[model samples]
Target: MIENDCSDLFVQNFSFWKHLTDTEKQFLCDNTAPVHYFKGTNVHNGNSDCIGVLLIKSGQLRTYMLSEDGRDITLYRLFGGDVCILSASCVLDAITFDVFIDAEEDTDVLLINSAAFRQLADQNIYVKCFGYQLTAARFSDVMWAMQQILFMGADKRLAIFLSDEISKSGSNEIKMTHEQIARYMGSAREVVSRMLKYFSEEGIVELYRGGIRIIDKKKLHSLI
Candidate 1:
């Protein structure tokens, strides 16, 4: 029988699981396992690792890529309850780009074996639909990120990022180093520092040794 221990959390996001037969459910449970990651851990590298689907049960994860010179840019992020299929690159022939997965906070993940998942998909219509939907969702996220980089000005993008962070934390100040900000924005630390200095002079933000405080959301919005 399929283990029911984590079914509540698992089913909350994968409701189609309820449609499976006992044998199918048991098969999945047998091939699946739970994994935990501490904040800042690299869950998957864009290397030779056989990627598999991950369902986040708690905390957050980031999907990003490294550039030729080693700078990084975030592609998309997955929060609790999000399903990740791009990580299952072996079964999906269309995934041409490389990305890395990392935990943004302490996290819980349910790992499904890629080969097993492909087998299930081949046998179950619901599983096929779920897989297709997941692929479409992740592709949309990637396209959105590409648009943000190609069309949005760097200052505007940074301002929007800071504004969103401030709103998320319900505080004007956020803890982040220039290096961290540079990694997210896919720029150099010096470039990020210079931009922050410009924003400070413009009365949009204040920078300290370890973090930044937004001073004017209106001005930041105006930049965009």
Candidate 2:
């Protein structure tokens, strides 16, 4: 069984939490549970599940929407120390689209109950500040994604995405499937495959089964 001791995490996430009364502190700690997700697992469904608040402890998650034809389009990715409220659309009332959260890597999160969080937000100034800040931050991110999709071409977007991956992993090699890339970029599998083939012919990238390696970073940058 996994240990649920997140008292330390609570303090680490909100240093001002130490100023609250012992009763309040204990209540928050007791309600803040730990959840672990294996790679490729769906952590939340905005259509059905009511996610309270998920504070990532480690690893990565992808929040995305599914099209009418079942194509998955990634909205944003979350990492450690990030607070996610879009998963709990039931509580927010502003979210209209169905978003699914899937674990891209093995992940651990601090899960707070929605009702408890609401109460805490109402009673504690620090909690309220954190909640509002998180909401605004997520909203900005969604807006940025909308702008990108609306203004940027797929080829340019794909180049930028690969550049980001290269910078993050510190290597030209990217271990991702064409299907996966399609989902991330909100494009069709056939389209992504065709685009990648074009990139390969142009010497922008070297393709392999289940992966791609950047050969000419300069060419990719120019496209973006």
Q: Which candidate is the best by TM-score?
A: 1
Q: Model 1 TM-score?
A: 0.90
The window of 10 residues in a row where model 2 has the poorest summed lDDT is 1-10
Q: Write the per-residue lDDT of candidate 1 for residues 8-80, one digit (tens) a residue.
A: 6557777579888878888888888899999999888885675588988888899998777777889888988
Candidate that would win on lDDT:
1
Sliding window of 10 residues with minimal summed lDDT for model 1: 1-10
Candidate 2: which pairs clash? none
Cα lDDT computed for each candidate against the true fold = 0.83, 0.81
Candidate 2 segments exceeding 4 Å error: 1-7, 15-19, 93-98
Pairs that collide in candidate 1 are none
Score residue 129 of candidate 1 by CA lDDT. Answer: 79
TM-score of 2: 0.88
Candidate 1 RMSD to the correct structure: 1.9
